[model samples]
Target: MTSDATASPAGKIALVTGAARGLGVEISRQLAALGAHVIVAARDRRQAEGTAAALRAEGGSASAMKLDVTSEADRLAAREAIEAAHRRLDILINNAGILIDSPDGGTPAERQPSEARESDLRRTFEVNFFAPLRLTQTLLPLLRRSEAPRIVNVSSIRGSLTHLSDPTSPVYPIRALGYDTSKAALNAFTILIAEELRGTPFKINAVHPGWLRTGMGGDRADMSVEDGAHTAVRYATLGDDGPTGGFFFLDERLPW
Candidate 1:
Protein backbone atom coordinates (compact mmCIF):
# COMPACT_ATOMS: atom_id res chain seq x y z
CA MET A 1 0.00 0.00 0.00
CA THR A 2 1.33 3.41 -0.96
CA SER A 3 1.22 6.05 1.73
CA ASP A 4 0.44 9.74 1.46
CA ALA A 5 0.40 10.16 5.24
CA THR A 6 -1.30 13.49 4.69
CA ALA A 7 -3.93 13.13 1.99
CA SER A 8 -7.45 14.33 2.83
CA PRO A 9 -10.62 13.00 1.20
CA ALA A 10 -10.79 16.01 -1.12
CA GLY A 11 -9.57 15.12 -4.63
CA LYS A 12 -9.54 11.48 -3.53
CA ILE A 13 -10.91 8.58 -5.56
CA ALA A 14 -14.07 6.72 -4.55
CA LEU A 15 -15.74 3.52 -5.68
CA VAL A 16 -19.43 2.87 -5.04
CA THR A 17 -21.08 -0.46 -5.84
CA GLY A 18 -24.60 -0.60 -7.33
CA ALA A 19 -24.13 2.99 -8.42
CA ALA A 20 -26.28 2.83 -11.53
CA ARG A 21 -29.50 3.98 -9.87
CA GLY A 22 -31.45 4.59 -6.70
CA LEU A 23 -29.58 5.29 -3.45
CA GLY A 24 -26.27 4.18 -4.93
CA VAL A 25 -26.57 6.59 -7.86
CA GLU A 26 -27.59 9.42 -5.56
CA ILE A 27 -24.65 8.82 -3.28
CA SER A 28 -22.22 8.77 -6.23
CA ARG A 29 -23.71 12.01 -7.54
CA GLN A 30 -23.28 13.75 -4.22
CA LEU A 31 -19.73 12.48 -3.72
CA ALA A 32 -18.65 13.57 -7.17
CA ALA A 33 -20.30 16.95 -6.55
CA LEU A 34 -17.92 17.27 -3.61
CA GLY A 35 -14.90 17.00 -5.98
CA ALA A 36 -14.07 13.31 -5.56
CA HIS A 37 -13.41 11.21 -8.62
CA VAL A 38 -16.21 8.68 -8.28
CA ILE A 39 -16.36 5.28 -9.95
CA VAL A 40 -19.91 4.11 -10.62
CA ALA A 41 -19.87 0.32 -10.51
CA ALA A 42 -22.94 -1.78 -11.20
CA ARG A 43 -23.88 -5.10 -12.70
CA ASP A 44 -25.41 -3.47 -15.76
CA ARG A 45 -22.84 -1.80 -17.98
CA ARG A 46 -25.47 0.23 -19.81
CA GLN A 47 -26.93 1.74 -16.67
CA ALA A 48 -23.49 2.38 -15.22
CA GLU A 49 -22.50 4.20 -18.43
CA GLY A 50 -25.67 6.26 -18.26
CA THR A 51 -24.92 7.32 -14.69
CA ALA A 52 -21.33 8.20 -15.58
CA ALA A 53 -22.56 10.22 -18.54
CA ALA A 54 -24.94 12.12 -16.28
CA LEU A 55 -22.15 12.88 -13.83
CA ARG A 56 -19.87 14.07 -16.64
CA ALA A 57 -22.69 16.26 -17.93
CA GLU A 58 -22.81 17.87 -14.49
CA GLY A 59 -19.01 18.50 -14.70
CA GLY A 60 -17.86 15.85 -12.24
CA SER A 61 -14.95 13.41 -12.44
CA ALA A 62 -16.79 10.13 -12.82
CA SER A 63 -16.46 6.84 -14.70
CA ALA A 64 -18.46 3.68 -15.21
CA MET A 65 -17.37 0.06 -14.69
CA LYS A 66 -19.29 -3.20 -14.78
CA LEU A 67 -19.20 -4.75 -11.34
CA ASP A 68 -21.35 -7.59 -10.09
CA VAL A 69 -20.78 -7.46 -6.34
CA THR A 70 -21.34 -11.18 -5.93
CA SER A 71 -18.64 -12.03 -8.47
CA GLU A 72 -15.04 -12.10 -7.27
CA ALA A 73 -13.74 -11.66 -10.81
CA ASP A 74 -15.88 -8.56 -11.31
CA ARG A 75 -14.67 -7.15 -8.01
CA LEU A 76 -11.01 -7.70 -8.98
CA ALA A 77 -11.55 -6.17 -12.41
CA ALA A 78 -13.11 -3.10 -10.80
CA ARG A 79 -10.15 -2.82 -8.45
CA GLU A 80 -7.74 -3.10 -11.38
CA ALA A 81 -9.63 -0.42 -13.31
CA ILE A 82 -9.58 1.95 -10.34
CA GLU A 83 -5.90 1.31 -9.67
CA ALA A 84 -4.93 1.92 -13.29
CA ALA A 85 -6.76 5.24 -13.36
CA HIS A 86 -6.31 6.63 -9.84
CA ARG A 87 -3.71 4.35 -8.18
CA ARG A 88 -5.56 4.23 -4.87
CA LEU A 89 -9.12 4.04 -3.57
CA ASP A 90 -10.02 6.51 -0.84
CA ILE A 91 -13.70 5.75 -0.31
CA LEU A 92 -15.82 2.63 -0.59
CA ILE A 93 -19.60 2.52 -0.29
CA ASN A 94 -20.96 -1.01 -0.24
CA ASN A 95 -24.50 0.00 -1.16
CA ALA A 96 -25.45 -2.84 -3.46
CA GLY A 97 -28.41 -4.79 -2.02
CA ILE A 98 -31.74 -6.44 -2.89
CA LEU A 99 -35.09 -7.13 -1.27
CA ILE A 100 -37.05 -10.29 -2.03
CA ASP A 101 -40.70 -10.38 -3.06
CA SER A 102 -42.84 -8.74 -0.43
CA PRO A 103 -46.31 -7.30 -0.91
CA ASP A 104 -46.81 -3.67 -1.92
CA GLY A 105 -47.60 -2.22 1.48
CA GLY A 106 -45.63 -4.96 3.23
CA THR A 107 -47.10 -7.61 5.51
CA PRO A 108 -46.96 -6.82 9.21
CA ALA A 109 -43.87 -8.15 11.07
CA GLU A 110 -45.81 -10.87 12.92
CA ARG A 111 -47.43 -11.98 9.67
CA GLN A 112 -44.08 -11.86 7.85
CA PRO A 113 -42.65 -14.85 9.74
CA SER A 114 -45.46 -17.01 8.44
CA GLU A 115 -45.05 -15.82 4.86
CA ALA A 116 -41.24 -15.99 4.77
CA ARG A 117 -39.53 -18.43 2.43
CA GLU A 118 -36.12 -20.11 2.62
CA SER A 119 -35.04 -18.96 -0.83
CA ASP A 120 -35.75 -15.36 0.13
CA LEU A 121 -33.52 -15.65 3.19
CA ARG A 122 -30.62 -17.10 1.21
CA ARG A 123 -30.87 -14.60 -1.63
CA THR A 124 -31.09 -11.60 0.67
CA PHE A 125 -28.02 -12.64 2.62
CA GLU A 126 -26.15 -13.42 -0.58
CA VAL A 127 -26.50 -9.86 -1.83
CA ASN A 128 -26.65 -7.90 1.42
CA PHE A 129 -24.12 -9.71 3.55
CA PHE A 130 -21.79 -11.96 1.58
CA ALA A 131 -21.21 -9.64 -1.34
CA PRO A 132 -20.18 -6.68 0.79
CA LEU A 133 -17.90 -8.80 2.89
CA ARG A 134 -16.22 -10.25 -0.16
CA LEU A 135 -15.89 -6.90 -1.93
CA THR A 136 -14.47 -5.16 1.13
CA GLN A 137 -11.90 -7.86 1.68
CA THR A 138 -10.85 -7.74 -1.97
CA LEU A 139 -10.42 -3.95 -1.88
CA LEU A 140 -8.90 -3.55 1.57
CA PRO A 141 -5.36 -3.09 0.26
CA LEU A 142 -6.62 -0.27 -1.95
CA LEU A 143 -8.30 1.31 1.08
CA ARG A 144 -5.12 0.97 3.17
CA ARG A 145 -3.24 2.93 0.49
CA SER A 146 -5.12 6.10 1.31
CA GLU A 147 -4.04 8.62 3.94
CA ALA A 148 -7.49 8.73 5.47
CA PRO A 149 -9.87 6.15 4.10
CA ARG A 150 -13.58 5.69 4.72
CA ILE A 151 -15.97 2.79 4.26
CA VAL A 152 -19.68 3.42 4.47
CA ASN A 153 -22.14 0.56 4.54
CA VAL A 154 -25.72 1.56 3.82
CA SER A 155 -27.66 -0.25 6.49
CA SER A 156 -31.15 0.31 7.96
CA ILE A 157 -33.05 0.94 11.18
CA ARG A 158 -34.73 -2.43 10.72
CA GLY A 159 -31.34 -3.99 11.52
CA SER A 160 -31.15 -2.41 14.95
CA LEU A 161 -31.69 -4.87 17.77
CA THR A 162 -32.69 -2.02 20.06
CA HIS A 163 -35.40 -0.73 17.71
CA LEU A 164 -36.58 -4.26 16.95
CA SER A 165 -36.99 -5.00 20.65
CA ASP A 166 -38.65 -1.83 21.84
CA PRO A 167 -42.43 -2.14 21.35
CA THR A 168 -42.73 1.68 21.28
CA SER A 169 -40.31 1.99 18.34
CA PRO A 170 -41.54 2.49 14.78
CA VAL A 171 -39.21 -0.10 13.26
CA TYR A 172 -40.28 -2.70 15.80
CA PRO A 173 -43.29 -3.48 13.65
CA ILE A 174 -41.65 -3.29 10.22
CA ARG A 175 -39.39 -6.32 9.95
CA ALA A 176 -39.10 -8.40 6.81
CA LEU A 177 -37.44 -11.52 8.16
CA GLY A 178 -34.82 -12.13 5.49
CA TYR A 179 -34.03 -8.55 4.55
CA ASP A 180 -34.02 -7.30 8.14
CA THR A 181 -31.89 -10.16 9.38
CA SER A 182 -29.44 -9.72 6.49
CA LYS A 183 -28.94 -6.07 7.34
CA ALA A 184 -28.35 -7.02 10.96
CA ALA A 185 -25.64 -9.37 9.75
CA LEU A 186 -24.17 -6.56 7.66
CA ASN A 187 -24.22 -4.32 10.74
CA ALA A 188 -22.26 -6.96 12.59
CA PHE A 189 -19.64 -6.91 9.82
CA THR A 190 -19.42 -3.12 10.07
CA ILE A 191 -18.70 -3.28 13.80
CA LEU A 192 -16.21 -6.12 13.53
CA ILE A 193 -14.33 -4.51 10.65
CA ALA A 194 -14.21 -1.16 12.39
CA GLU A 195 -12.87 -2.78 15.54
CA GLU A 196 -10.22 -4.57 13.49
CA LEU A 197 -9.19 -1.26 11.97
CA ARG A 198 -9.18 0.59 15.25
CA GLY A 199 -6.46 3.29 15.59
CA THR A 200 -6.10 3.40 11.83
CA PRO A 201 -6.82 6.49 9.70
CA PHE A 202 -9.90 4.78 8.34
CA LYS A 203 -13.44 5.25 9.59
CA ILE A 204 -16.03 2.57 8.99
CA ASN A 205 -19.67 3.13 9.86
CA ALA A 206 -23.17 1.93 9.06
CA VAL A 207 -25.87 4.46 8.21
CA HIS A 208 -29.66 4.14 8.24
CA PRO A 209 -30.81 6.40 5.46
CA GLY A 210 -34.38 6.30 6.75
CA TRP A 211 -37.22 5.01 4.61
CA LEU A 212 -36.64 6.21 1.08
CA ARG A 213 -39.16 6.30 -1.75
CA THR A 214 -37.00 4.16 -4.00
CA GLY A 215 -38.08 0.93 -5.68
CA MET A 216 -37.22 -1.02 -2.52
CA GLY A 217 -38.89 1.45 -0.15
CA GLY A 218 -42.12 2.02 -2.08
CA ASP A 219 -43.91 5.34 -2.68
CA ARG A 220 -45.20 6.19 0.76
CA ALA A 221 -41.75 6.33 2.33
CA ASP A 222 -40.77 9.64 3.90
CA MET A 223 -37.42 10.58 2.26
CA SER A 224 -36.53 11.26 -1.31
CA VAL A 225 -33.46 9.65 -2.93
CA GLU A 226 -31.76 13.04 -2.59
CA ASP A 227 -32.19 13.13 1.19
CA GLY A 228 -31.54 9.43 1.60
CA ALA A 229 -28.03 9.74 0.16
CA HIS A 230 -26.94 12.45 2.57
CA THR A 231 -25.91 10.27 5.48
CA ALA A 232 -24.08 7.96 3.12
CA VAL A 233 -22.13 10.80 1.55
CA ARG A 234 -21.29 12.14 5.01
CA TYR A 235 -20.10 8.79 6.24
CA ALA A 236 -17.97 8.26 3.16
CA THR A 237 -16.15 11.56 3.61
CA LEU A 238 -15.78 11.48 7.37
CA GLY A 239 -12.66 13.06 8.93
CA ASP A 240 -9.69 11.25 10.40
CA ASP A 241 -11.13 11.89 13.86
CA GLY A 242 -14.61 10.65 13.00
CA PRO A 243 -16.40 7.76 14.69
CA THR A 244 -15.92 4.17 13.58
CA GLY A 245 -17.53 0.85 14.59
CA GLY A 246 -20.78 2.72 15.03
CA PHE A 247 -24.23 2.98 13.44
CA PHE A 248 -25.42 6.45 12.43
CA PHE A 249 -28.40 8.31 10.99
CA LEU A 250 -27.00 11.56 9.62
CA ASP A 251 -24.85 12.59 12.62
CA GLU A 252 -26.67 10.75 15.36
CA ARG A 253 -25.43 7.37 16.62
CA LEU A 254 -28.08 4.69 16.95
CA PRO A 255 -28.22 1.90 19.51
CA TRP A 256 -27.02 -1.57 18.52
Candidate 2:
Protein backbone atom coordinates (compact mmCIF):
# COMPACT_ATOMS: atom_id res chain seq x y z
CA MET A 1 0.00 0.00 0.00
CA THR A 2 1.21 3.45 -0.86
CA SER A 3 1.48 6.20 1.73
CA ASP A 4 -1.20 8.87 1.68
CA ALA A 5 -0.25 11.79 -0.57
CA THR A 6 -2.04 14.25 1.71
CA ALA A 7 -2.56 12.86 5.21
CA SER A 8 -1.09 9.74 6.71
CA PRO A 9 -3.83 7.22 7.63
CA ALA A 10 -2.12 7.79 10.94
CA GLY A 11 -0.17 4.84 9.47
CA LYS A 12 -3.23 2.62 9.92
CA ILE A 13 -5.24 0.38 7.58
CA ALA A 14 -8.99 -0.17 7.21
CA LEU A 15 -11.28 -2.78 5.68
CA VAL A 16 -14.87 -2.07 4.61
CA THR A 17 -17.13 -4.96 3.69
CA GLY A 18 -19.57 -4.94 0.72
CA ALA A 19 -17.83 -2.01 -0.87
CA ALA A 20 -18.96 -2.66 -4.45
CA ARG A 21 -21.57 0.08 -4.41
CA GLY A 22 -24.10 2.13 -2.44
CA LEU A 23 -23.32 2.90 1.19
CA GLY A 24 -20.45 0.44 1.26
CA VAL A 25 -18.73 2.16 -1.65
CA GLU A 26 -19.18 5.59 -0.13
CA ILE A 27 -17.85 4.45 3.22
CA SER A 28 -14.72 2.97 1.64
CA ARG A 29 -14.15 6.13 -0.36
CA GLN A 30 -14.46 8.33 2.70
CA LEU A 31 -12.11 6.19 4.76
CA ALA A 32 -9.53 6.37 2.00
CA ALA A 33 -10.01 10.12 1.87
CA LEU A 34 -9.02 10.23 5.52
CA GLY A 35 -5.61 8.78 4.48
CA ALA A 36 -6.12 5.14 5.55
CA HIS A 37 -4.98 2.45 3.18
CA VAL A 38 -8.36 0.76 2.70
CA ILE A 39 -9.24 -2.70 1.51
CA VAL A 40 -12.38 -2.40 -0.61
CA ALA A 41 -14.03 -5.68 0.17
CA ALA A 42 -16.88 -7.15 -1.84
CA ARG A 43 -18.26 -10.49 -2.93
CA ASP A 44 -17.05 -9.95 -6.50
CA ARG A 45 -13.32 -9.62 -7.10
CA ARG A 46 -13.87 -7.62 -10.29
CA GLN A 47 -15.98 -4.92 -8.65
CA ALA A 48 -13.81 -4.82 -5.57
CA GLU A 49 -10.68 -4.35 -7.64
CA GLY A 50 -12.42 -1.72 -9.71
CA THR A 51 -13.25 0.30 -6.62
CA ALA A 52 -9.71 0.01 -5.32
CA ALA A 53 -8.43 1.05 -8.72
CA ALA A 54 -10.61 4.13 -8.63
CA LEU A 55 -9.18 5.02 -5.24
CA ARG A 56 -5.64 4.51 -6.44
CA ALA A 57 -6.22 6.70 -9.48
CA GLU A 58 -7.41 9.45 -7.16
CA GLY A 59 -4.21 9.23 -5.09
CA GLY A 60 -5.50 7.14 -2.15
CA SER A 61 -3.82 3.97 -1.04
CA ALA A 62 -6.16 0.98 -1.35
CA SER A 63 -6.47 -2.61 -2.48
CA ALA A 64 -9.32 -4.98 -3.23
CA MET A 65 -10.23 -8.34 -1.72
CA LYS A 66 -13.12 -10.75 -2.06
CA LEU A 67 -14.94 -11.08 1.26
CA ASP A 68 -18.28 -12.78 1.41
CA VAL A 69 -18.92 -12.17 5.10
CA THR A 70 -21.06 -15.31 5.35
CA SER A 71 -18.18 -17.51 4.19
CA GLU A 72 -15.36 -18.42 6.56
CA ALA A 73 -12.84 -19.01 3.77
CA ASP A 74 -13.21 -15.52 2.39
CA ARG A 75 -12.99 -13.96 5.81
CA LEU A 76 -9.82 -15.90 6.61
CA ALA A 77 -8.20 -14.85 3.35
CA ALA A 78 -9.13 -11.23 3.97
CA ARG A 79 -7.51 -11.37 7.41
CA GLU A 80 -4.41 -12.97 5.99
CA ALA A 81 -4.13 -10.29 3.32
CA ILE A 82 -4.42 -7.53 5.91
CA GLU A 83 -1.88 -9.19 8.18
CA ALA A 84 0.53 -9.57 5.31
CA ALA A 85 0.19 -5.97 4.13
CA HIS A 86 -0.31 -3.89 7.28
CA ARG A 87 0.41 -6.44 10.04
CA ARG A 88 -2.67 -5.02 11.82
CA LEU A 89 -6.01 -3.46 11.03
CA ASP A 90 -6.88 -0.21 12.78
CA ILE A 91 -10.48 0.10 11.56
CA LEU A 92 -13.21 -2.24 10.41
CA ILE A 93 -16.51 -0.99 8.95
CA ASN A 94 -19.12 -3.74 8.81
CA ASN A 95 -21.21 -1.96 6.21
CA ALA A 96 -22.57 -4.90 4.22
CA GLY A 97 -26.31 -5.65 4.74
CA ILE A 98 -29.68 -6.23 3.09
CA LEU A 99 -33.34 -5.29 3.48
CA ILE A 100 -35.80 -8.01 2.48
CA ASP A 101 -38.40 -6.71 0.08
CA SER A 102 -41.72 -6.79 1.84
CA PRO A 103 -45.14 -5.85 0.56
CA ASP A 104 -46.08 -2.21 0.80
CA GLY A 105 -47.08 -0.94 4.29
CA GLY A 106 -44.79 -3.53 5.94
CA THR A 107 -45.63 -6.73 7.83
CA PRO A 108 -47.52 -5.30 10.74
CA ALA A 109 -46.99 -6.91 14.13
CA GLU A 110 -50.67 -7.78 14.30
CA ARG A 111 -50.41 -9.74 11.06
CA GLN A 112 -46.97 -11.22 11.68
CA PRO A 113 -48.36 -14.34 13.31
CA SER A 114 -49.27 -15.86 9.95
CA GLU A 115 -47.48 -13.76 7.33
CA ALA A 116 -43.83 -14.02 8.32
CA ARG A 117 -41.85 -16.94 6.91
CA GLU A 118 -39.06 -18.84 8.66
CA SER A 119 -36.74 -18.48 5.65
CA ASP A 120 -37.12 -14.74 5.55
CA LEU A 121 -36.23 -14.42 9.21
CA ARG A 122 -33.28 -16.78 8.84
CA ARG A 123 -31.65 -14.95 5.95
CA THR A 124 -31.97 -11.58 7.64
CA PHE A 125 -30.32 -12.82 10.80
CA GLU A 126 -27.55 -14.47 8.82
CA VAL A 127 -26.59 -11.20 7.16
CA ASN A 128 -27.37 -8.56 9.77
CA PHE A 129 -26.70 -10.29 13.06
CA PHE A 130 -24.41 -13.30 12.79
CA ALA A 131 -22.21 -12.02 10.01
CA PRO A 132 -20.93 -8.89 11.74
CA LEU A 133 -20.34 -10.69 15.00
CA ARG A 134 -18.50 -13.52 13.30
CA LEU A 135 -16.28 -11.18 11.28
CA THR A 136 -15.33 -9.20 14.36
CA GLN A 137 -14.51 -12.36 16.29
CA THR A 138 -12.30 -13.62 13.46
CA LEU A 139 -10.45 -10.31 13.21
CA LEU A 140 -9.98 -9.65 16.93
CA PRO A 141 -6.35 -10.74 17.05
CA LEU A 142 -5.38 -8.51 14.14
CA LEU A 143 -7.28 -5.62 15.68
CA ARG A 144 -5.56 -6.15 19.04
CA ARG A 145 -2.27 -5.47 17.25
CA SER A 146 -3.25 -1.89 16.54
CA GLU A 147 -2.47 0.93 18.96
CA ALA A 148 -6.09 2.10 18.67
CA PRO A 149 -8.65 -0.23 17.16
CA ARG A 150 -12.16 0.77 16.14
CA ILE A 151 -15.12 -1.30 15.01
CA VAL A 152 -18.11 0.48 13.52
CA ASN A 153 -21.21 -1.61 12.96
CA VAL A 154 -23.41 0.09 10.38
CA SER A 155 -26.84 -0.29 11.95
CA SER A 156 -30.20 1.40 11.51
CA ILE A 157 -32.54 3.38 13.74
CA ARG A 158 -35.17 0.66 13.42
CA GLY A 159 -32.72 -1.66 15.16
CA SER A 160 -33.38 0.07 18.44
CA LEU A 161 -35.96 -1.81 20.51
CA THR A 162 -36.45 1.33 22.51
CA HIS A 163 -37.53 3.35 19.47
CA LEU A 164 -39.61 0.54 18.00
CA SER A 165 -41.60 0.22 21.22
CA ASP A 166 -42.32 3.91 21.45
CA PRO A 167 -45.49 4.62 19.47
CA THR A 168 -44.53 8.28 19.15
CA SER A 169 -41.03 7.59 17.90
CA PRO A 170 -40.00 8.85 14.47
CA VAL A 171 -39.01 5.33 13.45
CA TYR A 172 -42.54 4.01 13.76
CA PRO A 173 -43.13 4.77 10.08
CA ILE A 174 -40.96 1.83 9.06
CA ARG A 175 -41.31 -1.68 10.43
CA ALA A 176 -40.04 -5.01 9.19
CA LEU A 177 -39.49 -7.73 11.77
CA GLY A 178 -36.84 -9.63 9.81
CA TYR A 179 -34.73 -6.54 9.23
CA ASP A 180 -35.49 -4.74 12.49
CA THR A 181 -34.99 -7.78 14.71
CA SER A 182 -31.69 -8.65 13.05
CA LYS A 183 -30.38 -5.17 13.67
CA ALA A 184 -31.48 -5.38 17.30
CA ALA A 185 -29.39 -8.53 17.61
CA LEU A 186 -26.45 -6.68 16.05
CA ASN A 187 -26.80 -3.86 18.54
CA ALA A 188 -26.68 -6.38 21.35
CA PHE A 189 -23.44 -7.72 19.89
CA THR A 190 -22.00 -4.23 19.81
CA ILE A 191 -22.82 -3.67 23.47
CA LEU A 192 -21.49 -7.03 24.55
CA ILE A 193 -18.24 -6.63 22.59
CA ALA A 194 -17.71 -3.17 24.01
CA GLU A 195 -18.21 -4.58 27.49
CA GLU A 196 -15.76 -7.40 26.75
CA LEU A 197 -13.19 -4.89 25.52
CA ARG A 198 -13.59 -2.50 28.44
CA GLY A 199 -10.35 -1.13 29.97
CA THR A 200 -8.72 -1.78 26.58
CA PRO A 201 -7.86 0.86 23.99
CA PHE A 202 -10.32 -0.55 21.43
CA LYS A 203 -13.75 1.00 20.90
CA ILE A 204 -16.80 -0.75 19.47
CA ASN A 205 -20.02 1.08 18.71
CA ALA A 206 -23.29 0.85 16.71
CA VAL A 207 -24.34 3.72 14.47
CA HIS A 208 -27.62 4.61 12.78
CA PRO A 209 -26.84 6.03 9.35
CA GLY A 210 -30.47 7.11 8.93
CA TRP A 211 -32.60 6.25 5.87
CA LEU A 212 -30.38 6.68 2.84
CA ARG A 213 -31.01 6.67 -0.91
CA THR A 214 -29.44 3.32 -1.61
CA GLY A 215 -30.74 0.19 -3.34
CA MET A 216 -32.19 -0.88 0.01
CA GLY A 217 -33.21 2.58 1.21
CA GLY A 218 -35.36 3.16 -1.92
CA ASP A 219 -36.19 6.59 -3.37
CA ARG A 220 -38.01 8.30 -0.54
CA ALA A 221 -35.12 8.43 1.85
CA ASP A 222 -34.43 11.90 3.23
CA MET A 223 -30.68 11.57 3.55
CA SER A 224 -27.94 11.37 0.95
CA VAL A 225 -25.23 8.69 1.09
CA GLU A 226 -22.72 11.25 2.33
CA ASP A 227 -25.07 12.25 5.15
CA GLY A 228 -25.68 8.63 6.07
CA ALA A 229 -21.93 7.92 6.19
CA HIS A 230 -21.06 10.76 8.57
CA THR A 231 -21.82 8.87 11.76
CA ALA A 232 -19.99 5.73 10.67
CA VAL A 233 -16.90 7.74 9.75
CA ARG A 234 -17.00 9.64 13.05
CA TYR A 235 -17.22 6.46 15.10
CA ALA A 236 -14.49 4.78 13.04
CA THR A 237 -12.02 7.62 13.73
CA LEU A 238 -12.90 8.62 17.30
CA GLY A 239 -10.17 9.78 19.66
CA ASP A 240 -8.66 7.65 22.41
CA ASP A 241 -11.20 8.96 24.93
CA GLY A 242 -14.28 8.49 22.72
CA PRO A 243 -17.33 6.64 23.96
CA THR A 244 -17.56 2.89 23.45
CA GLY A 245 -20.54 0.50 23.54
CA GLY A 246 -22.67 3.47 22.56
CA PHE A 247 -25.39 3.93 19.91
CA PHE A 248 -25.19 7.10 17.86
CA PHE A 249 -26.32 8.94 14.69
CA LEU A 250 -23.72 11.52 13.73
CA ASP A 251 -22.92 12.77 17.25
CA GLU A 252 -26.22 12.17 19.05
CA ARG A 253 -26.51 9.25 21.46
CA LEU A 254 -29.35 7.02 20.33
CA PRO A 255 -31.64 4.87 22.45
CA TRP A 256 -30.81 1.20 22.31
Writing each residue's lDDT as its tens digit, candidate 2 over 206-248 gives: 9998878877776777888988887787888877768899898
Q: Against the correct fold, how does model 1 do in TM-score?
A: 0.93
Q: TM-score for each prediction?
A: 0.93, 0.92
In candidate 1, where is summed lDDT lowest over 10 consecutive residues? 1-10
Question: Would you give me the overall lDDT of model 1?
Answer: 0.85
Could you say which candidate leads in lDDT? 1
> In TM-score terms, which candidate is top?
1
